[model samples]
Target: MLELRKINKSFGSRKIITDLDLQIEQGSILCIVGPSGGGKTTILRMLAGLESIDSGEVLLSGQPFDPTNLKEQEQVVGVVFQDFQLFPHLNVFENITLAPKLSLKQDKAVYTKNAEELAQRLGLANLLNHYPYQLSGGQKQRVAIARAMAMNPKVLAYDEPTSALDPGLSQQVADLILEMKQAGMTQIVVTHDLDFAKRIADQLYQVTPVE
Candidate 1:
C-alpha cells in the first residue's frame, strides 16, 4: 500500500498541495482528476520523485518513501509523461532498455530479455527497430509504457495519458492499465477526462487548487 499523510507543497509564495492525504492499495488503479492548476500532476511528480513535498510523509508498504533517493525511487516507481518522451534518435528497443542499462547496470542479456518481453506484451515487438518519429501516437505511448516497465518498478504513474488519443485508443489504454493491475502492478493516473477515469479507476481522487 502507498499512503500520503498530510502532504504539503508550494512554489514561491503560492501553495500547490496543502494537507493532502491519500492511500492506494497494492495492485490497484488510482485515478486523480480535477481542474487545471489543482496539483493533480504535482501529486504524480512527487510519487515519481520528480517533485519535493514540503511536509508530511509518503509511505509505501508501511515504510517511509524518500523522494530524494534516486536509486530507491527508480526501483520503486516509474512515470510516463504526457508527451510520451521517447528519444528521436533511439529505436524502440534501445529506448526501452536505456534506463535499466544506465541505472541498474544490468547485464546486456538480462535487460535485452526484459525489454523484448515488455515490447511483446505491449504490442511493440514488431516495431523494435523503429524510431519514435516513425511511430503513431498510440505506438509511442506503448513504447513509453514499455520503457517504464523495463525498470521493473512496482508502481507506475502516468500524466494525462489519454489527452492526445481518440476514443478507441483511449479504451486500449484503459485495457492495458487493467492488464497491468492483473499482473500485480499498481498504477496512478493523472488525467482531466472524467469518463476515462470512471472507466478504469479502482479509487478516485480529486485535487483542488490551494488558495
Candidate 2:
C-alpha cells in the first residue's frame, strides 16, 4: 500500500537516510528497529508530510506524495508519536474528536457518536470529559489511539509507541495494538522493544547502522 524508493533525507552535512528503499503491504504490521537518530522518525515525518524528502519518493498506493493536499492523503495513513501529543487543555472528548470534526465537518451528533464508539473500543468511555492532566500515561496514549482511529485511517505509523510507558503500561499499549492487528489494521511501528515487536509485526526491518 506504500512504497519508499531510494528515499533520502538530510540535515546539512549529515545524511540520515541514504538510498533507503521499502515496500509495505496492505493489512500487514511492520517493525522498524534501530538506534536513536537512525532516521526512523524522519521516515514517519516524510510520509506524514510534516517534513520534506530530500530525494526520491514516497508513494501511497501508486501516486507520489504531495505535501500541500492533505485531504488527498486523509484515508491513507495515521501516526502516533512517542510523546502522545494530546491537547492539554481539551478534554479527552474534545481532543479525540477534533481532527474528524474539523476535517470531515459532520454534524456534532454524528461525530459525537463516532467519537464515543472509538473511545468505548479503546476503553476510554468513562474518561471523555477528563483532561490530559487527569489521565494516566496509558490513558493519554489510548486517547491518542482513539484520536487516530477517529480519522478512519487505513495505514497507521507508530513511532516508539510504548517507549515512555512503564513495563505494565507498555504491555497494555501492545495489547491494544494487537487488537488492531487482529482487525486488519496495517501498521508500521518503530520500536526498540523486541518482544513487543515480535508480538505484533508480520515483518521486521532492522534499520542499518549509519557510518
Candidate 3:
C-alpha cells in the first residue's frame, strides 16, 4: 500500500495541499477527481518525483518513500502526463525503448522484447514506425502508456488521461486501465471527469485546493 501522511505543499505563500492523507491499496485503481487547480496533478508529480511536499511523508508498503530520491522513485512509480509527452524526433519504437535502454543498461534484447510486448498489448504493433505527429490522439496516448509500462513500475499514475479523447475513446482507455489492474499493476488516475473516474476507479478521492 502507498500512504501519504499529513502531506502539505505550498508555492510561496499560496498553499496547494494541506494536511492531506491518502492510502492507495496495491492492485487497485484510485482516481483523484476535483475541480481545476485542485492540486490533483501536484500529487501525481510528487509521486513521480517531479515535485516536493513541504511537510509529511510518503510511505510505500510500510517503507519510507523519498520523493527526492530519483532512482527509487523511478523504480516505484511511473507517470503519464496529460500532454502525452512523446519525443517528436523519435519513432514509436525508439520512444518506447529509449528509457529502458539508457537506464536499465541490460542486454538490448531484454528491453527490446519488453518494448515490443508492451506495444503489442497496447495495440501499437503496427504503429511502431510511426511518429507522434503521424498518429491520432488516442494512438499517441497509448504509446505514452506503453512507454511507461515498459519500465515496469509498481505504481502507475495518469494526469487527465481522457481530456483529449471523445467518450468512445475514453471508454477504451478505461478498459485498458482495468486490464492493467487485473495484471496486478496499481494505478492512480487524476481526472476531472467523474464519469470516466466512475468507469475505472476502485476508489474515488475528491481533492480541493487549499486556499
Candidate 4:
C-alpha cells in the first residue's frame, strides 16, 4: 500500500537518510527500529509529508505520493507524534473529534461516533470529558492514539508511540496496537523499542547509516 523509493533527506552537512528504500504492503504492520540519530523518525516525518524528500518518491496505493501536498496527504495518512499533541484545554472526545470536523467537514454524527467508538476501543471511555492536564501520562498517550485513529486514514504512522509512557502503560499501548493490527489498520511505527516492535510489527525494517 506504501512504497518509499530511494528517499533522501539531509540537514546541512549531515544527511539523515540517504538512498533509503522500503515497501509497506497493504494491511501490513511495519516497525522501523534504529538508535538515536539513525534517521528513524526522519523517515516517518518524510512519509507523513512534514518533511520534503530531496529525491525519490513515496507511493501510496500505486500512485506517486507527495507529502508536499498537504490536503492530499492529510486525506491518506494519520500520524501520532512521540509527544502527544492533544489540546490541553479540550477534553478527550473533543481532541479526537476536532480533526474530522474541521478538516474533513464530517457530519456531527460521524465525529461523535468516531470519537466515542475510538475512545472505547482505546480504553479511554471513562476519560472522555477529562482535560489533558487532568489525565496521567498514559491517558494522554491513549488520547493521542485515539485522535490519530479517529481520522480513519488509509495508513497510521506512529512515531515513537510508547517512548514516554511507563512500562505498564507501554504494555497497554502495545496491546492496543495489536488490536489495531488485527483490525487491519496499516501502520508504520518508528520506535527504538525493538521488543515492542517485534510484538506488534508483522515485518521489521532496520535502518542504518551507509558506510
Model number with the top lDDT = 1
Ranking by TM-score: 1, 3, 4, 2
lDDT (Cα, tens digit) per residue for candidate 3, span 1-211: 9999999989899899988899999999999999988999999998878898789999989999787785722677888889999999999999999888888764789987898899888899999999999999999899999888888788999999999887778888999999999999999999999988998999999987665
Across 1-97, the per-residue lDDT of candidate 1 in tens digits comes to 9999999989999999888899999999999999889999989888778888899999999999787676632667788899998999999999999
- The lDDT per prediction is 0.90, 0.83, 0.89, 0.84
Q: Give stretches of model 2 more than 4 Å off.
A: 72-75
Clashing pairs in 4: none
Please identify model 1 stretches exceeding 4 Å from their true place. 72-74
Q: How many clashes does each candidate structure show, in the order listed?
A: 0, 0, 0, 0
State the TM-score for model 3.
0.96
Query: Residue 179 in candidate 1 has what lDDT?
Result: 92
Give the lDDT ranking, best first. 1, 3, 4, 2
Error of 2 at 152 (Å): 1.8
lDDT of 4 by residue, 1-211 (tens): 8888888888887888878888888888999997888889888887776778899988888898687686731656678888888888798889998888988789999889888888888889999989999998888878888887777788888889888888777788788777887888888899988999988888898877533
How much does candidate 2 score in TM-score? 0.92
| Residue 23, candidate 4: alpha-carbon lDDT | 85
